[model samples]
Structures are given as structure tokens and as C-alpha cells.
Target: MSEFETTGPERAGPERRPRVCVVGSGWRFTGGLSHYTCRLAGALADRSEVSALLMRRLLPRALYPGRARVGVKTAALDYDERVDVFDGVDWYWLPSLFGALRRLRRNRPDTVVFQWWTGTVAHTYLVLAAAARARGARVVVEFHEVQDTGEIRIPFVAAYTRRVLGALLRRSDAFLVHSEHDRQLLGDLFDLSGRPVTVVPHGPFDHYAVTHRPSPDGVFRLLFFGLIRPYKGLDVLIDAFHRLAPEEVSSFHLTVVGETWEGCTEPIEKIEASPYRDRITLVNRYVSDEEAKAHFAEADALVLPYRRSSASGPLHIAMSNGLPVVLSAVGGLVEAVGEYAGAVLVEPEDVPGLADGLRKARAAAGTRYPDPHTWQRNVEAILGRSAAAAEGGTR
Candidate 1:
């Protein structure tokens, strides 16, 4: 029998849900995109017949920044049981790629949603996009960033990406972005004159907030979490911490928890040389969900001083926990957290402004129940009729 010939028990609904295939990084690679892939698949399952085709191996071990833990089981998140998942395609393995193509045909999805972050998967995406289109499926590419900072630094890679992404975007039927800022960047970089582009808010990463507990210590704890890369502006955060008055510094403690990436060591060096080093705790490694939960639980506020970003996973984690956040206003981050009651936006790279924001965050430190973002709204915006009918190409 053909794969599509087999039918499961009928679900109670007004009509049969559309079948969807979500393509993204798998848990084997274990990063923000992997988490987002799983979460999105699970959410889509609530309203669609969902299948996930994940990238198991993105690149060669030597070239990967997180090579040491490439295949390690570091994530606690998994896909919904209702969603069919293929653990996935590899960058260099032709057999794995063939298997993914076969899976796509077997699933016969109505729409294939591709997660765009790095150029490493462009070839694979182009191949899969063609396969999906051949099967009469609409293709939707969700833009995570215009171009990866690390990838943009390499001239050849940048050139290759420009050609490949241009082709892929031309073939795509629709586009999804996290914010209007991202929509503008997409328009500026590519020609989307008649394409349907919808702005969807990032869903809450609240699954880890079950471990929330207030700090027993009297000190007001501040956290700066996520990968420590050059673009993350960790050095500016260090400088902001130092600018705090002696009395204010005495009342606060800063925790820097993240895996070092792209050899960005200046922030760590600054931390080691600081006069108030005793007040800072640094966990310079990628941590498990349980460990991350513990970090959020003991913290009074979360601070992310990014020089540039489309969106942030850590910021969503803070919002889910209702933890007060002090974020640098840049890129899509400003609109992403602007409405949150506990958010204090400061100018990017402004050390004094960050210091002021930190003070404000400390003064307003307390849990605010009910996170604003939801997966249901995100799902609706991506597949709903309004998204298809959006005006002037993007909404």
C-alpha cells in the first residue's frame, strides 16, 4: 500500500486539517533553532497534520563552533506524539538526503515550512523545496535572520548565500517573519513584490519555567544568558555592570551563563579583571534545560545586551517566567519586548543607558504572571486566511 493510502481514526473538526512538514535543525545539533523546530512542530500538531524533517548533521565537526557536543543529548524538549518526525538529513550524506525526500513524498504535506537561519542548509532546502513543489505543496520560508553574522564575514560564503537564497525566495509561495523589522530587512535584501509575508510573534519558551523559585539570598540577582558571541555585546554588559555605584553594586550579583562561541573571549577577560569579580558568577558552557530553569528561578532579572538580533530565545525564556528584562534596543528586539510590562529597553552599545536600565529592572524586580506570547496565535498567523490576504506583500 502507498504511504498515503493508510488512514488513521478521524478527528472531530469542521474539516480535515491541512498536512504540514516543518524542516529545521534536529536535537542532535541542539541549539535555539532545534528547540524552535520542535516547539513549532508540536504547536502545529494542535491544528494540522504535522511532520518534521530535521537536519541531523549541519556541517563538519571542525567547522562547527559547538563541535564538542554536536551529538550530545542536551535538550529536554521533544516533538508531540501526534507529529511524525524523521531524525533527519545530513549536510554531506547523500543517502540521508534521499531518505528525507522520500519522507516528504510519503507524508504528502499541503505546506512545507523551512526554517532559515544559516546558509549551511541552503542546498538541502532547495532540493527539498523542489521535491515539495513537485508534489503540489506550497513552500513557506521563515526568516530567522537576514544573514548569520559569522557566515556574512566569509566573502565566498556570503556570495554563495546571496545566489542560493535569491533562488529559494523566488521559489517560495509565502514568507513568515517574527517582527516588522525582519519584514523590512527581508524586503531590503530580496525582491518580494507580490509575495505573501506575515509577521508572527515568537511563542513563549515557558516549558522550563515549572522550576521557578525565588532566591533565598538577600542579594538582587541579574542574569545575562545565551551564547557569548561578538554580536551579543557581553563586553558592553560588563562595562555597564562596572558603571554601577559602589552601594548599588554591593546590593547586586550578576550571573553570566552561556557557551563561548566564535572565540569571543574579551567579555570573559573583562569579568576576570573586574574589581567586583566576587559579585559575578560565570558558567561558561551550554547548559541543560533543568540547569537553565534553575538559573532563571534564582534570578531577579534577565539582561541581554545584544548589539544586533532579529529575536532572542533567552528573552522569551525570561518573558515566560515573567522575569524582569533589560534588553538593548536594536533590530527586531525592540518590538519583540516593547509591550512587556517588565521590559526596560536601552540603546544598543550604550553602557550608561544599560546601567540605568539595570537599576530600573532591579527596582521593578518581581514576577508578573501570564506570559503575553502564545503558540496558538503564532500558529494562526502562519496558516490563517488573514496571513494569505495580507496587504502590500507583508504585514
Candidate 2:
């Protein structure tokens, strides 16, 4: 079980490599999920046949936020498949959930890995799992968050969503959780003590290749990027930045660049209230890949002092950019950053500690990841035994 101790090849080839159906937003969105799905599918293709299943339309055009397309306008993926399922646009009563199920049954993939995130898709994914199970394909759900931040807003909705998700989880043959903390959280969320759960560390964001060609300049700078949400504890980060002595504050500039959502204005408010407001820049909107690259290139460190945490996608981005991180040692972050000399782990919401952590990172040299996670290693970890099982079937 210890990957560090393994001396031989990561995999023992199967007579027929187990075909995988990785279900997610193939190229449909531009964020952590789509990036993860696209890269993972590509990596799996290196060892086994891999296909990406995409939703034609997540929501009806009338209800869609920006554009009602199957893909992000700025991104593209090589693998994409359509599910001809009939869904009721008005309510969850439509049998369209079976569309993906039917597609999986027809394909009869060796394993179906469902991208498990958001309660909004719980009902559909629950039914999809049941359908996949009925058709005899091994089901694996990769959980991003054991729970979502928005869940607290609607307790009743969250309760029902959890019930539906629990059913799907019980029906799954295997599970892939990002870290041991997440594995434990999944158990707390639902009864997973009986399921085969593997701690597959999320790979670094290696897809930012052409866009990753610059290093931070002379001025000490800190960057925060991603969708802005309340649970991320940006206010605490801003307050901590304010707590730094005036001389230390003058030595650095903080860049807050990310898309903000409804009711997540506390960070913005904190920025405006700070005496060092002139030194802070906030781009409260969606950023392009080039823009993201530039931000990372110029940042001495990426700061993420979250209120609580799980496996952090932003942490992966920071590592891929080779920027040191000043992060709260909550959830899986402490383990994910794993002995990276550049990481400065601090107490969540501890104003003085966060300030000190940021100061330390200013003088710190970016460290290499002690255990660099790769999608190839992740795919192998999930499917190595399955591949051997596939070979046994041939025998």
C-alpha cells in the first residue's frame, strides 16, 4: 500500500487494459472540475482506453447564468461524448438521468468514475449510479467536497440531497477520495466503512504549460485565485494582511483575483476598510488563462487561509506555478503540501499567525513538492488492481 516503498513498475499490464468512462464536464466548464476531468482522461488514455462523458446542457438556456453551451468558451478537450437522455427541464421528475446510464450500459465500460461534486446534480447522479450498477459496470465516485458551502443556506434541500447521495454511494463498488481527511469526511457524511476507498492525492495542475513561463519580480507579492466563496475565509486573510506592521506591509502587495459569487462580499469589504488598501488590488471577476499565468508569475506566494478546507485545487495551482504557499493547515492541506519547504502552514483565522506566515513566505524560497502527485500515478492507483483483475478474466 505504500507507494514510496514500491521499486518496480507502477502497473502490471492487463491482457486488455480496463476501459474507463470518466463522467464529468469533459470540456464543458472552465474551473477545477473540467481541468481535472480533461487531464485525468488524457492521462488514463496513456495506459487504458478513456472516454469523457459530457452533459449537453447542464441547465436550460432560459435558466443558465452566462452561456448555455456544453463547453467553456475558453477551453477545449479531445474526448467528449453525448448522452441521449430525456430530461425534464422544469423539475427532477424527468427520466433523463437514465440517459447517461444507458450510454454507460451500451459502452459497458470496465469502470465508471463519476465526478462527485455539488448537491444540484445529486438526484441525477444517484439514478445514474443505480443504472450503471444494474448494467454490471464497476462504479467509482471521486468526491471533491464531502459537503458544499452552499448547503448550509438550505438545510431541507441539503438533507434530501444527502439522502440521495448516500444511496448512490452505497451502490458504488469503489471510491476515490483525494486525501485521508476526505476519506474520513466521506465516512462521516455517509456510511462508507464497507466500501473500498482509496486515498488518491490529486495531481498537480500540470495543464498550465504554455501559460507558465514567468517568475515573480523584485516586489514581494501574494496571490489568491479561484471562485470567491464565503467559506474560503478571505476576510480573515485580509484582516491578517492588515495586522502586518506598516513597514512589512509596505514590503509586499497582495493581489486578490478571482470570480466572486452572490453574498460573498466580506472580503471586498475588508479590503476597502484596510489602511493598506492602496497596496491591495482586487479583480472580482473571471480571469483568463493568460491573466492567471501572469498573476502566478508575479506572486511571491499564494495565500489561502481558509475557514475550513478539503483537498484544495488552488493549492495544486500554486504548486504547478512553483509559487510558495501560505496556507491554513486545515483539512487535507497540511498533508497535501507534505514537507514542501516553501509551505508556511498557519492557524485558520489566527490574525497574528497568518500575518507572520505571510512574512515568512516573503523570505522563503519556493520548494519542490516532496511527493509530486501526477494523474498517471492517480489513475494507476485507482485501476492497478482492476487491471490485474482484468488480466485474470482473460486467463
Candidate 3:
């Protein structure tokens, strides 16, 4: 209610529903951020007055790898017409900031939900959030990750990124996190002893699910999904694939799906060049939704032995397809794997442990996500009167 509130009928009667503006990576046809923006915005539109302000490029061409633009070229806007989309935020252009801000001022949404994941877009978001706060709109930051999960080899670069994320968190009025680990991390990183941070689980990626299919021949297929990054432990998984017993290695085919970013696939390619080359299939590109669905449908299990992560969408995607997951015990993964019926959790980078987990996959059952996280509950926790009960969830 700072400076953005209009006193009378402007805030009531015909437009009684809460006006929500979601600004983030839009229409990414194959990735997590785009998937999240589309799903959450569509759900919000059902109960609230919602519109999405999406960025055309998350990073410059030089910065992004394996793709020309961030999103896919689909005929429909944001994969659905129900959710209103303003699909023109070019991060490279400074003028785009003013345009987005002008739209915010003219439209004046009650809540401006800015998606925060990487520190690269911090400066732009900081200015935008400040303007929204000045205009009296409550700014709710949905943190996918407090810091970028992409492996940063440079020490100085990593340090600066953390500082930028801390600044952005300070600017936001309330926070919407997906897990308790993220909620605790937010409190420890900033001075939020009793802040309004609602912990809403990520909705099931049920949209990605397809009818299950048996593996090719007799070989068990293991899928290591998502972008190739150092932190995701792809190298470790590849090494484990080679180190497996001859009979064990012969029993399975590893499907390494996803694009290699910033020239990070050398190690994976090296492993593929080894004798295990015949056993591992490296798909180095962004996959279409239909392609992704087919991969999940046939795969025996999804392995994500991440070095670090706040929460996981790939895990949810696997569960949605009723696929058993074999992930490392790190971040919110401990809590996430527990919700699934037949997931195998091992120590991060534990090569032998991961290898053994893969061997155990033959006996694993297709998991059941009995209670999927609903978007209705997520939006309500952010805007309804029950929001007060979701607060004070801090260390």
C-alpha cells in the first residue's frame, strides 16, 4: 500500500480480483524457467487478474549457448491464449526497462511478481522492483534459486553473483520459495527474521507426462536430463557408467539429454569417446515438449546427482511420468525424493554409490506422486488472508 494504491472504486467492484503481473523468462518451449512461467501465470489467471511480461532473451547470444534465442518459436503465445502475454523484454536493450516500467505504471497491478533465479539480470530487476514499490505495488519475488546454479569456475565472478542476489532479495517485499531449504537459505542470506516467505511446492509437470513404454531390447535406459553444467555431476555420472561391472554396464544405456552450455561438454564428450561410447547416447540440444515426453516415457529412471541445487523440476517431471528417480542427497532433494514412491537417494558425487543406485533401478517400481502440488494453493498462499499463516517460516 506504499504509493501504488488508488483509494476507491478503481480497486473494487468490477475488478475485485487481485491484479498480478508476472515478469520472467517467457515461453521457453523446453526448459524449466519457461515451463514455470507458463504454468504459474496460466494458473494465476484463473483466480486473479494476471498478465506476463516476458524477456525474449535471458542473456546475450555470446552468453547463451546451444540456442539462438531463449524460447521456442511456437505459434501460440506462451503456449496458451488464456494467460495475457507482453512478449518483448530484450535484456540487451536498456530502453526495454523503461518500456516495461511504463507498462507497470500505466496498468498498475496490485502485485508485481518478478522471477529471480540468476544474478545476471539483478541490476535490471532492482530498478524495476524499486519503481513498483514506489508506485505502491507489492513486489513478490519467486526465487527459483537464490544464486545461479550454473557452475562458475571463476572465484571473483561467483562472489560478485552472490552479492547481486543478496541485493535483489533485500528489494523484494515478500518471497515465494519452493522448498524449506530455500526458505532457510533466504533468511540466513538476508535480514528476514520474520518476513512473508510462503513455501509452496512446485506444481507437478503433469503436462510433460506421456504413456509409458518399455525400454529398447533388454537394456535398461537411464536418462540424465537438463543442461550440461559442472555442478549437475554429469561427469561423475558418466564416469560411474564406465566404472560399472561389465555385466552391470551391459545391462543399461545412459541417455544424456540436454544442451551443453558455454563449452561445458568436453568432459562428457571425452567419456562418450571411451568404450562406454556405445552405451551412452548424448543428445546435445534443447528438446521439444513432445520429444521430452517421449524420452521420459521410455526411460527406466532419471538421474540428477547435482553438486548443489535449491529445488528440482526435473525430479517433478520424472514423477509426473511415473518414472523412478535416482538423485544425490543434496539441497531440497532429500525432502523431494521422500515424496516419491521408489526414488534412490545417494551422496553427491559418490561415483560407486550412484553406480549401485543405477543397478538397483531394475527392481524399482514406477513412482506415484499421490499428492501433486497444486497452483491454486500456491497463488492463494501468496494473496489470500491465509498468507499470514505462511509467514515467520524462517530460521
Sort the candidates on lDDT, descending order.
1, 3, 2
Residue-level lDDT of model 1, residues 98-140, one tens digit each, is: 8898899898887789999999999989999998887878788
Q: What is the lDDT, from 0 to 100, of the residue 389 in candidate 3?
A: 43
Spell out the clash pairs found in candidate 3. 4-135, 4-136
Query: Model 1, stretches more than 4 Å misplaced?
Result: 1-15, 385-394
Candidate 3: deviation at residue 189, Å? 1.9
RMSD of 2: 6.1
Give candidate 3's root-mean-square deviation (CA, Å): 3.6
How much lDDT does each candidate structure score? 0.85, 0.68, 0.72
Worst 10 residues of 2 by lDDT: 386-395
Clashes of 3: 2
Residue 294 miss distance in model 2 (angstroms)? 1.8
Residue-level lDDT of model 3, residues 195-244, one tens digit each, is 46777667767787678788658778899988887778888888778778
lDDT of 1: 0.85
Best-first order by TM-score: 1, 3, 2
